[model samples]
Target: MRWSKALIPTHKEDPSDAETTSHKLMLRSGYIRKLTSGVYNYLPLGRRALLKVEAIVREEMDAVGCQEILMPVLSPSELWKETGRWDVYGKELWRVRDRNSREFALGPTHEEVVTDIVRNEVRSYRELPFTLYQIQTKFRDELRPRFGIVRSREFLMKDAYSFHRDEESLDETYKSICDAYTRIFERCSLTFRPVEAATGAIGGSHSHEFMVLSDTGESEIIVCECGYAATDERAEGAVDPHPCDEAPGEMERVDTPGMKTIEQVSEFLGIEPHKLVKTIIYEADGRTVAALVRGDREINEAKLSMALKADLVVPAPPDVIEKLTGAPVGFAGPVGLDGIDVIADHTVEPLVNVVVGGNAQDVHLKNVKPGRDFKVTAFHDIVLVRKGDRCARCGAELNSFRGIEVSQAFKLGTKYSSGMNATFLDEDGVAKPFIMGCYGLGVSRTVAAIIEQHNDKDGIVWPLSVAPFAVEILVVSMKSEECTTLADTLYTDLKTAGVEVLYDDRDDSAGVKFKDADLVGMPLRVTIGARGLKSGVVEARVRKTGEVSEIPVDDAVQGILHILETLR
Candidate 1:
């Protein structure tokens, strides 16, 4: 590719709306252009980089004996309804209607469609334990898409689904897929951690997320020195009982006008946040329940759903709260409350004389003690794990960090197959649902994450394995015939040697060419200038290390190839 003909439009200023480093660099480097709020058009350079990532994913998946197959972008609503995900996915599933009034969904994931296909085709146990994968586009109606392609509404993904006859078969395939994921990310030069994660709407027994460590990431993860790592939603919080010995005072209600938040109530009552218990009202599976946690802690809704064994768990509406507690929102408490299940966090079990809502308008209860003032139906680990929290494994202090989720693998079990009635005949002539597993790698997001981890002050420092071009040849003085002739010759020689080289044959200034080269982040650069030509050598600069060396003019091609080998 020649710079004069290539559409490598770079800018001097970053986009004002860009909030992350990857977003800013991708725009300024002319890799992509925004078409809409959550949509982008990948230019030539960006397309090449994405293709490289896709190739790696294909090789890894194929190496694991997973066959490649393509599914439709639009999946029928019947398939989603068979699995009861039509309502479970909520507004995130993109719904559309055909001219004949038939409904279809733009697939966010293909669990339902794949299950439908397998159920119709595979009828015997002999055809079980196979995996099918596809590299295609996925759509989701993101409420707030941010951080460029990291959270885009539409993007490219590589998703694979496996079918099995029993738990043992599913387990074997799950481990192999996880191993392939590790190799895929390693080859892309990403520094990541595979942490246990919640299954979410996927309805799986367990899952693991590959998170690239970055300060600008949206998800928080907890890691312990004992090799126990998980997303905050899945990490277990160790219950440390701070047993208070103070004698319980009689509960009394006081008029705290307009102080509802913990900060406001604590400041008004002259108490610490830990001395107060917060009552959160949630509607779980059409039943109202109250959850109690320390004011300083947050309720993990995922944990709450698991504890309740409910398909859906969301906060109660303001009207429901008002009708149940005889007060406005934020004033509902467990004290004097009846006919509703009251679940308490383990940390709230050893409290004495803790303040709580008064179950009335602008009122709060003081000197209230658990087991005396209210009844807790059960206790569970239902709080978000944070820094300084003890790990459940080795009791070490857990550390928290932010990261970008690049890939995830789920042991789906029979969630989809059982729901859709996808079964196969066994040796005994009995039919049973196939055990299933799901694995996904975000191809586009991996590109963005690579930039997040491997970027410098100038621009993206692409790794050699996934770089758009392996080498960039810069003609420092295009006006000088000697420099031009040597650069053209080197460019042809490098091409003949099977190197992906970008020749800057444009008549631009040396400064402009050098700046663009650095911005595009080619792995290696060869500088052919009149000054260097006079010294009987050409300059070779490594993009990652910023180390420059001189190669003798007689051996430019061989020297460049050797440096490329060192880069790998």
Candidate 2:
């Protein structure tokens, strides 16, 4: 595309309201314009970039045997209600009413709609494994829409859903899609990690999220140096807290006056935080249950929520907490509890004789033993892990970092199929619900994540993989005969050679032209200047690296190709 014919707006100052670099660059460069909070209107440049990304996604998804299909952006509320998602999905879902007052929703996702199609078409096991995908707009009423496209309420998404008759088929297809995602992110030039994911709200047994590591990321992923990593939703694996196998020490009580925090108590006793057992009280199933975890840990609320199978399980208030454990607000322990069930996090299990609450005011117990000193009705890996902890996989130390999730795939395992009675006839003529898998990539967020992972101080140094244009040919002085003649010739040469070029034919200054070229973030910039006319040498520059070379006019095409190959 020619720059004179394109809408590549360049700004000297960053927009005051722009919170993210991607948002600022995109707005200033005229890639996109905001319609409202959490809503955007893609301009010419952004539309081209989105089309390029969509093309790559289509190719990769099709390579993995996924068939492209278009589902309605507006879905019937009855379909969602059948899956129980309409009630459970909360207010994030946007609902509307038609002329008849029947409810409809702008799809947040297409699981129910896709499953409805599968339930009608796929009858026998022979036609079991099928994948259908689409690139479409999705709507959600985000509670706090921030970070631009990273958390937009209305955005474009590429969602693929796979249906299978059994677990083995589902597992095989799941692996195939994961591999496709690997290729997809690589093509987008995004540095990402596929970590184990939690199935919150979207109930599923197995899930994985592709997270791009960045300081601006909203979610945190705790990873062990042993290559063991999991997002909070699915990290219920067994983790031994690497306890010291010393003999059970004597039990004693120590007075802890006015110290409620773990740090305060640890400093008072002059012991490692790992040596203390932290007992937490919560209201579960209309009764108070005390959960004991290590001091160096935080409770995995998701795991606890799943274990209790309660309607809601959050941290209880001290007044409500004191009533259950028979102690003052700051003091509560597992001493001789019969009705109150105790849950132990994975880390606290290996402690031979640990210090815990004494079930009395202003006192705590030391050398307490599990099974011998206290009873635990349930055991789980609900402890929040931190650095220096051993890996659950290869015994390496753990580390933590924040990341933004750009894509996800999950084995839904009949969660909705069973609820909606989406069943097929079995060999014995009995109805069996189909197992399902869901895959999604944030089309808009991927664009922002690319900027997050790729940009530099100058502006967005768009990676060639997703750049709006491959080359930008700037005419330093569009009105000058020498510059215009050479610029016109170079533009024709590049375009005729099947290279995508954006020619800056505008009557602008050299500084403004160069600045706009950088701001537009095209990978290559070929400048036709006064020096080029004097020496018969045109300048070709690579945007990512501040490297420019003077090439003979006849060899301009070859120089541009070489630079493109080098950037690749």
Candidate 3:
């Protein structure tokens, strides 16, 4: 590729709206352009990088005996309706109507479509164990899309689904795909961790997310020194039941005018937040319940849903609170409550005397004992884990870092197969739903995450396996015949040797050529200047390490080939 005929529109200044490093460098380096709020146009350079990522994913998926196929992006609503997701998918699923008034949707995932395919073809257990995959674009209408391709509404993904007849067979395939995902991310030179995750809205039994560590990432991950790591939603940590050893005192009622929040009461009483108990009212399947946690901690909705064994749990309405506690919304408590269930955190039972709401407006109870003053139905672990929390495994202080999700593997069991009637006859001549697994890799987001981890102040530093081009030949003085002839000869020789080379043959200044080369961030750069030609050598620089080595003019191609091999 020659610079004169390429669409590498390098710019010096960053865009005004760019917030993250990948977003700014991608635009300044001419890799992508914004088409809309959460949509983008991938230029030639960006497309090349995305293709490389897809190729790696294909190789790994194929190696695991998973066959590749293409599925339609537009799917009929009947498929989703059968699984009860047509109404449960909420606002993110884009619904449209055709000329005949038939409803359809742009798929964010292909579980319903794939399940319907297997239901029509497979009848007996003979064809029970198989996997099919696809690499295609997906659409999801994000409410507030930001951070460039990291959270785009439409992007490319590699999704695979497997069918099995028994739990043992499903477990075997699940482990194999998890190993394959580890290799795929390792080959791309990413610093990532595979953490346990909650299968949100997918209704799976178990799942693990592959996350790349970066400060610009949106997801928070917890890591312990004993090799225990997980996302915040699924992280389990130990809470000290006896956080303090204070003597019990008699309960007293105090008038607190306009002080309903924990912060206000803590300030007015000159007490620490952990010394107070925070009670929240929630409606779980129309049953009003009060959840108790320490004042410093927040509620984990995922854990709460699991504890209550309900489909969904939301905040109780204002009227429901008043009816249950005889007070307004923020003044509900577990003490002296009636006609409702109480779920308390494990840490709340150890406190001798704590502050709580008085079940009446403009009043609070101080020095209230748990067993003496109030009672709870049950205790569970429902506190959201944060940094500095003790590890449940080793009791060491847990650390946290921000990361981007690159891949995920799930043990889906029979969630989709049972719902969609994808059943087959077993050897015993009994009909049963197929056991299943799902694996996915974000093809476009991997490119953005690579830039997030491997970049400097200058620009992107692409890894050798996923770089757009292997080498770039820069001509220092395009007007000088010596520099032009030498650069052209090296370009031809490198191309003949089967190297991905980009030649700067345009009549541009030396500064502009150098700046553009750095912006594009090819692994190897060969500079042919008039001064270096006099010494029978050219300057070769490594983009990642900034190491410059002088190579003889005759050994330019051989030197570049050796460097490329070492990088891999």
Candidate 4:
């Protein structure tokens, strides 16, 4: 590709709405341009990089014995409705309708469509235990998409689904896919961790997310030195129960004014936040339930939903809370709460005296004791794990990191098969639901994450394996016929040698060419200038290391290829 003809529109200023490093760099580098909120148009350079990523993903998936297939981005509503996800997937499902008033959805994922294919085609266990993968576009109605393509509404994804006859087969394939994922990210030069994750909306028995470590990431992960890692929503750590050696104190209602938050109430009562119990009312599967936790902690809604065995769990609306507790939003309490289930965090079990809501305006209860003042229907670990918390596996203090989730693997078991009746006949002639697994790699997001981790102030430092071009031949002085001729000769030689090379043949100044080269960040750069030509050599620089070497004019192609090999 020639820079004079290519649409590499490098910019000097950042986009006004760009917040993260990746977003700002991508715009300035001319990789993508915003078409609308949460949507972008990939330019030539961006498309080339994306294709390389897709090629890597395809190779990895193929090496794992997975067959490639394509599915429609517009999926029928019947398939999602069959799995009960049409309503359960929430507003992000991108629901639509055809002219005939038939419903459809732009698929955020392909689990339902894949399951439909398997159920219709395969009927025997002999054809089971195979994986099908597709690299395609996916859509989601993101309420607030930010960070450029990292959280875009429309993006490229490589999603794979596997079907199995039994749990053992599913487990075997799951491990293989996870291993492939590790290799995929490593090949892209990403520093990441695979952490246990909650299977949100994508119903599954177990899942792990490949999180690229970055301070600008949107997801929070809890990590331990003992190899225990999980997304904060799925992390489990030891919590010490409140120590109470003294007898239970009598609960008393006290009045202040307008103390709604835990901080406000604790400040008004002159007590630490840990000394108070937070009563959080939620609508778990349409049943009103109150969850109790230490005021200093936060409720993990994923854990709460799992504990209640509910399909959905959301905080009750203000109106519902006011009607249930006879008070405003933050004043609900479990004391004397009637006609509802109450679940308490394990950290609150041993408390003898604590503060709680008074269930009335401008009121709070002090010295309230659990088991004496309110009844807890059950106790579970429902608090979000934090730094300094004890690890459940090794008893070490936990560490936390913000990360970008680039890929995720799920052991779906029979979540979709059971729901949609995707079954195969076994040797015993009994129909059994197919055990399934899902693996997804965010192709577009990985590109953004790579920039988030691999970039400096100059621009994106692309890994050679996924770089848009392996070598860039810059004619530093196009005005000099000698420099332009030498650059063209080297470009031809490299192209003939099967190198992915880009030629900056435009009549641009040395400074502009150098700046654009750094912004695009090719792996290797060969500078052919009049001064260098006079010296019988060309300047070669490695983008990542900034290592410069003088390559003899006669050996420019060979030297550039050698440097690219080392980059790989």
Candidate 5:
């Protein structure tokens, strides 16, 4: 490839709207251009990078005995409706209408479509225990897309779904795909951790997220020294009870005036933040439930939803809270509540006397006991785990860090197979739903994550395996026949030697070519110049390590190949 014929529009300055490091670097390097909010156009260089990542994913998925197939991006609404996800998917699903007003969806995932395919084709146990995969584009209507391609609306993904006749087969294939995913990310040269994660909208019993540690990541992860790591929504912590030793006093109503929040009440009563009880009102499956926890603890909604076995749980509106508790938003309490269930955090089990809402405007109750003054229907661990919290595994303190989710593997069990009626006949002549598993790798997001972990001040330092070009030959003066002739010879020889090389024969200045070369960040940079040619040598620079060396002009092709072998 020659630079003069390539569309490498390297920019001198970062775009004004770019926020994350990957976003800015990609723009400056001319890899991608923004088409709209949460949408982008991958230029030639970006497309090459994406293809490289796709190749790695394909190789791994193929090595694991998975067959590749392409599914339609536009799926009929009937398929989603059959599984009851048509309404459950909500706004993230891009729903549209055809000429006759029939509904269709730009698929954010292929579970429904893939299951539909299997149900129609495979009707017996003889066709069981195989994985089907595709590397394709996906769409999700993100509410607030940011961080470049990290949360984009449309992006490339590699998704694989496996069907099995028995639990044993499912387990074996799950482990195999998990191992393959590890190898895939490792070959991409990423430092990542696979943590236990909640299934979220994916509707699975078990899942693990492959996360790349980054400060700019959207997800917060809790990691413990005992090797227990999980996303904050799913991470568990010890519930150390704080017993009340002081004698209980009679409950009394105190005039809080305009004070409503925990901070205001704590300051007015001269008590620590943890001494007060926090009351949260939520609508779980259309039933108003009051959740009580320590003043300093925040509710983990995911855990709360699972505890109640509800399809959806959201914070009650101000009107709903006032109507149910007879108090304003922040003044709701659990004492003497009517027509609603009350749930308390496990941390409240040991408390003897605590402060709660008075259930009146601008009033609060003091010296209130849990069992005596108020009772909870259930106690569960719905507390959000934070930094320094005791780990549920080994009692060590947890550490919090941000990470980008690059991929996920799920033990889907029979969630989809049962819902979609994807069943097969057993050898004993009994029909059963297929045991299933799902694995996904975000191809475009992986590229952004690679830049997030591998770039510096200049630009992206692409690892050799995924670099658009392994070697880029930059001629100091294209006008000089000597420099151009030597650069042409080296480029031809490198290509003939089975190396991915880019020749910069454009009529551009040395500084311009050098800046673009570093910005694009090929693995090895071979500089051909009049001065170096006179010395019977050329310069080679490693993009990742910034190590420069002089190579004999006659052996330039071999020298570059040797360097490429050492990287990635």
Candidate 6:
């Protein structure tokens, strides 16, 4: 592509509203333009890059057993209603009415629609283990869309769904998809990690998210030094149980004037925080519930909510606590009560002698045994494992890092199939719900995340696998016959050798052309300058390493081809 014909609207100054590195560089380099808060318009350069990404996706998907198909961006509300997502999807699902008053929606996802399509055709389990995929635009009404395409309301995505006959079959397909996703990201030349993920709104049994580690990532990863890594939501760790390992002393009563916080009470009585059990009131499922955990650990809300399977769970308000427990917030505990439903963290359940609230102001009861002193309906992990905890997989130290989810694969296990009656017949001719596994990659978000991971202080350093152009040939002095003629010859040769070359044949200074070439970040750069031309040579620069060398004009294409091959 020649600069004279190509739409290379390079900018020297950054846009005011571009907050992310990808958003800023993409606009400044003439890749994308923002139309609104969550909407964007892809210019010629941007469209080319997106097309390259799509091609990569298509190739990788086809390499696996996936057959590509195009799905509708607009879908009927009746499809969503069949799966009961019409009410559960909340505001993110864009709902509309047609001219005839028929309801429709711009699909945030296609699980409902895809399953609905297969339900009519899939009758036997012999048709199981089939995968279908698509690269299409998805819409979601993000209430606070920011960080450019990373959290946009409308974006491109690659979604694949698989049908299975049983749990083992689903497991096999899930592993295959995970492997395929790894290859896809690898082909895109992204530095990413596949971490365990929580299937929150999607409702799945097991899922893994491919996260490109970046500082600006939204998801936090709890890491361990000894190869132990997991997301905060799925983190299972080992923590000291309030340091009460030493034989706890006998139970006792303490009276104070006005100590509310655990620190205050521990300091006033000269006791360690590990010896006291903290009591909290949570209002869940329309009931005022009391939960007791150790004073040292904070509660994991995701863990607590999953244990109860409640629709809503939150800390009980101040006035509601006083009316239900006959005490203020901090001073409520289970001492003389054995009729209330209570749950404790696994580490907290083994405490034979621990201090707890005495249901009054500035009072505490020590030597509290969990099962002996207080009755409980369940004993499970109610608190989160903090930093300095054992790993769930290999028992290593747990560390933490925040990430943005680029893709996820889940084992749906008939969650939607049963709900929508999408079943298949077995060999015995009995109808049974089809098991499912779903996978998705956010194409636009991946673009933003690649920039987040691979950019430097100057600008984005696009990888060869996804870069629209493999080499940028800049005529340093376009008006000079030697430079322009040599640049034109090199561009044609590189293109003939199957290299995607961008030729800057405009009348520009060496500095301006070099700066624009660097901003565009093709893997290889060829500079035809007067000094190099006189020496029968040209300057070749590596965009990623900023390494430049003088090479003979005849060897320019070969040298660049070698670099591009290595980078890809």
- In terms of lDDT, which candidate is strongest? 1
| Candidate 3 local lDDT, 359-445, one digit each (tens) | 899888889878789988888898888889899999999999999998888889999999998899999999999899999889999
Question: Residues 1-568, candidate 5, lDDT per residue (tens digit)?
Answer: 9999988898999899999999999999989999999999999889999999999999999999999999989999999998878988889999999999999999999999999999999999998899999999999999999988998999999999999988799889988988998998898998999999998888788889999999999999999999999999999988555667989889888888778889999999887767789999999978999988888788898898999998778899999999887878778998899778888888877776678888889999988888889888999888988998899989998999999999998889888989988899999999999899999999999999999998988888999999999999999998889888888888888899988888888998999989999899998999999878889999999998989988998888777777777774
Candidate 6 Cα outliers beyond 4 Å, as residue runs: 13-20, 224-228, 245-292, 310-340, 350-375
| Residue 253, candidate 2: C-alpha displacement in angstroms | 10
Look at candidate 1 and give me any clashing residue pairs.
none
Give per-model CA RMSD: 1.1, 3.8, 2.2, 1.1, 1.7, 3.9
Distance from true location, Cα of 480 in model 6, Å: 1.1
Tens-place lDDT digits, model 2, residues 429-452: 877999899999988889888888
| TM-score for all models, in order of appearance | 0.98, 0.85, 0.94, 0.98, 0.96, 0.86
Candidate 6 lDDT score at position 251: 67
Model 2 bad stretches (over 4 Å): 18-20, 98-101, 224-226, 236-290, 309-340, 349-375, 427-429
Q: Where is model 2 poorest over a 10-residue stretch in terms of lDDT?
A: 232-241
For candidate 1, lDDT tens digit of each residue in 274-369?
Answer: 889999999998899999999889999999999999989999999999999999997888998899999999899889999999999999999998
- In the range 266-330, model 6's lDDT, one tens digit per residue, is 88878777767788888776676677778777777667777878645678898987776676767
Which one wins by TM-score: 2 or 3? 3
Per-candidate local distance difference test: 0.93, 0.83, 0.88, 0.91, 0.90, 0.82
Clashing pairs in 5: none
Residue 527 displacement (Å), model 5: 0.9
TM-score of 1: 0.98
Residue-level error in angstroms, candidate 2, position 451: 1.1
Kindly indicate the candidate among 1 and 5 with the higher lDDT.
1
lDDT of 3 at 228: 91
Which of the predicted structures, 5 or 6, would earn the higher TM-score when compared with the native? 5
* Angstrom error at residue 397, model 2: 1.8
